[model samples]
Target: LSTVIDGDRRMFAVTDFAGADGSAGLACDTSAAETIRAEHERTVRSHADTLDQLNTAVAIFDTDEKLRFFNQAFQKLWGLDSGFLLSAPSNTLLLDRLRSEGRIAEQPEWRRWKENLLSAYRAVESQEHWWHLPDGKTIRVVANPQPKGGVTWVFENLTEKMDLESRYQTAVRVQGETLDNLAEGVVVFGPDGRLRLSNPAFVALWGLTAEALKPNVHVSAIRDLCDQHAANSPWGGFVAAVTGFDDERRDRRGQIELINGNVLSYAVIHLPNGQVMITFVDVTDTVNVERALKDRNEALEKSDQLKNEFVQHVSYELRSPLTNIIGFTELLSLPATGPLTPKQREYVEYVGSSSSVLLTIVNDILDLATVDAGIMQLDISEMNIDRTIAAAAELVADRLDEHRIKLAIDATEAPASFHGDETRIRQILYNLLSNAANYAPEASTIRLTCRRLADAVEFSVHDDGPGMPPDVLESVFRRFEPRANGGRRRGAGLGLSIVKSFVELHGGTVRIETGQDRGTTVICTFPDKPSGIPDTPAGIRDAAE
Candidate 1:
């Protein structure tokens, strides 16, 4: 029936009406019934609008299993058209459509699964399920039962959440495994001054049981255990750091020695998250090795000192006796002292030569001892290069003539005058010539060459004789290590050693060139202006060089 009431049009669906006496009657106002119907429609529209704005997909199915209402999110989540969604398809029909499109995972027992899912309409409580879709999406399906015999399905996408949880768990497992296999002891403490994490290595290093180092143990308790083993415990500092009471939150590293003779190196690190970590590594072997090496080095240095002192004492004692022997041999050879037979004169000559050779050996030893003591001062002066060379040759002339080896002097490239210790230069030249003459073949020519380079002077003594072997050349400059090597005779073996020492004192270098069947050449080079040696002892530096 339709009518105008209070200038407003109102309509109502009218059924058969009856009067109080069971007789046919006229229509009532029906305004109260119309008001209730209008309010119900406004409430339903408000609820539908709120549901449409939600992100979660929601669909309501009636007792007949047909979709009664759905929100906008439901359509978007399923990627379904508006026409199809508005047509109100059944829940089974929607599932089949999604399956056909490969959106949901395949079910082996499709019929049974569908029946169980549809059973939510008869259930009083809500049911939940997890759907792993073929498209790599995870959907949490909740079938919430309604009092009016329907089900409200909620599909919450949980793919990203599950992925994060899986990665976090994996990371935790990997960290645990890494710590368990490390050689270094590791322990972590929280800001509450309690232990948070510790590995087996930490327990073993501190000689504590696993039970004693369990989680949440206070730092003070661990300090007590440390004091029993370690000579100095660092736990007092650790407690302050973990409790946030330390003014400077800095990392520390140090070594700890145990009473049992073991040593450990430790490091304390502060993390940005207010956590502290302590690590320890065993260093007992390294410490022991260092101590042994130090002791051995000290013993070697003392032995060398004794050797130098012995050589100096022996040389000084022999000098006085040798001087008297040479003087008496000279007197006996002169006519004013006595006339002697040919055999007596020859014996005197032999005695004088033998005394001279002994004196030379003693003098060489004294010179070496002085150098070793770091007190040998060079008398540097300007000298004529040609005169120095001539004088050195005259000294070694008798040996060269005896061997029938000719001396060949080549000083065309030498400077007229050079600044150096003239006495040392003459001694250097004499030692070089003597070494060459000792090894030079009879009737062979020994070449002595001197050249002026850009900033230095070079002198070379070449001998035509069998050269030194590789083994002999290896220690050719060592004192007292003489090698015959087809030479005429062997003396004190200090010729090359003295040459090297004197040349170096004059700021010079010496090198040798030789090979099998090819003669040996000893070359020495001196700088133009020598860098004066320091007044202080330089024995260590000279020996090392």
Candidate 2:
């Protein structure tokens, strides 16, 4: 027998088991049919129990649009009595009863809403609606059209859920307000180094528009923008910190100076959920204050240096002619083949003396100019310290004699030899002695001492002259401030300055020890080996010049 079984425990279709005659009645198995019917009843009861346990309201309609099955939850969802639901009303009649009893919301156009809801019966796919009933409950209804000509409607109550979601959104809005108004820039990046959230302050700090900060932008793109505003960008560090998965995550903090003169302090913190939070704070005012003070000091020093260069170069260019004038004047004053009267002799003497004074001024200016130009190259070689000192003393011997200052050489503590520039060393010694000669009184003992220490050779000229007053000592090494106090002649004031400059050029130092009552001791130190680079600023020939 060939037979078909169905859910209602009834025969659905049959096929004849006869041969060519087609005369055999289907031999149905009564016992197997009873067994299939029992299985169907058990399966339907199990499904009904499962649906009753659900929170969602589920209702099914027959091919004629009459209510066929519904769980207890479905009745509760609509606040309907079980008696009316069991009566099996048509789908439209059920909706009409619910609408009349104020269970469903009254639509703006009732006939139109009813027609729309009824369209689910012929719909080939599912339809959904969020219904706000007149009883103040919200229902999320899903209408799924069946393959066999009917529809299944599932209603979900979402009133409490929506209320909670609304509160959460409100809290998020408040937090967003707080972040937008903060002065500190805040950026949150995901574990992939892609940007997740950034506050307005973060965008404004970098001077970028909000449109540039779209969702899921990689950290490198932001770095590129940040680097556009910074000379030496610190964004590379930020990118590395964001994408790093190292076992140790240390919080990083640093201060960065931008090309636009803004200084920002940044901190990167690793979040617990594999995100990185970076904060930037503008500290430009504090950093600029310190930088401004430092720049001002540097500017003043540069101005002073430039002024020295001006005096030096002009003096150097003028010295050659001035020297010729002094020399020729002295030659003319001498009686080689002719003799002059008393008045002519006086005039010649005056001319010679004035030329000599002018020559002295020109020479001072040239020496200072050479030092100011910073190209004062030294001839580094081993030198006889005593001989160098002797040559320097002889150069200033006449001035010493004119001032009545007796030169006393003290080499008791002196070295045999040292390594330095010979000509420059001689000049340094001569200038110090000349400075002392111009200040020392007549018959005063001017002592020259050379002491050899472990690392350097120290030379000192001690003059038993009236010491410099507070004001003169303050600017003792300033060029072109000529002041002769009881001396035979004033100087161009470049003597001490030259000594200091040349000493420093040899990587040495100069110092003065003097007070009102004490005689002055001007000390100059030269290193034994001359191993250090000169402390003077670098000299480069200008390309344009």
lDDT of each: 0.86, 0.82
Worst 10 residues of 1 by lDDT: 536-545
Residue 385 lDDT in candidate 2: 84
Would you estimate the TM-scores of all the predictions? 0.77, 0.51
**Candidate 1 per-residue lDDT over residues 1-545, each given as its tens digit:** 88887898776565675678685545666777888988999998999899999988999998888888898888887898888877888988998988888878889998899899888888999999999988788899999998888899999888889999999999999999999888899999888778989888888888999889887998889988888997787777777777866757889899999888889899999977678999999889999999999998788777777777887798899999989999999989888998999999999899999989989889988888878877899998888899999999999999988978899999998999888988888999999999999888998999999999999999999998899889988778877777898888887778888888888888788999998879899999998888785432323222311
lDDT of 2 by residue, 179-245 (tens): 9899999999999889999999899889888888999999999998889998888889888888876
Counted clashes in each candidate structure = 0, 0
Among these predicted structures, which one has the highest lDDT?
A: 1
Which candidate gets the maximum TM-score versus the true structure? 1
